[model samples]
Target: MTEQGQSMLNRTVRKRHQLSAESIAKDLQISCGLQISITAVRRELHGMGLHKRAAACKPYITKCNAKRQMQ
Candidate 1:
């Protein structure tokens, strides 16, 4: 890939919460004018070892419970 393509990939991957192949492809298409499909993005991410992984969310605690627990 060219410098422009690399830049697009970086930007797309960075913008996402986690490296998402789909978002990367969409961003590349919009930013780099590549018109690439999601599958292509997945392949590229897989090649780069940047495939999206499941993200774990922290448990939510209410403010009242938090205060009580702090006591």
Candidate 2:
């Protein structure tokens, strides 16, 4: 694992929440002098066990009429 690359990605991601793999690659190129591709960045992020996800708000279904269905 590239600690330097990962640190750079973490810092940039923390500062700019919308930064993606492509952005991270560019930032690393400009700041750390490392030439990287989006796919490589994405793979590294995955290897680090970081994934993108959204919170889901779901309603419960607990009012069904069981007796009525039996009839």
Using lDDT, give the best candidate's number.
Answer: 2
Q: What is the C-alpha lDDT profile of model 2 across 1-71, one tens digit per residue?
A: 37877788777777777547887888889987988888988887777666666659975544476555666
Which portions of model 2 miss their true places by more than 4 Å? 59-71
Candidate 1: list runs displaced more than 4 Å.
Answer: 1-3, 55-71
Best by TM-score: 2
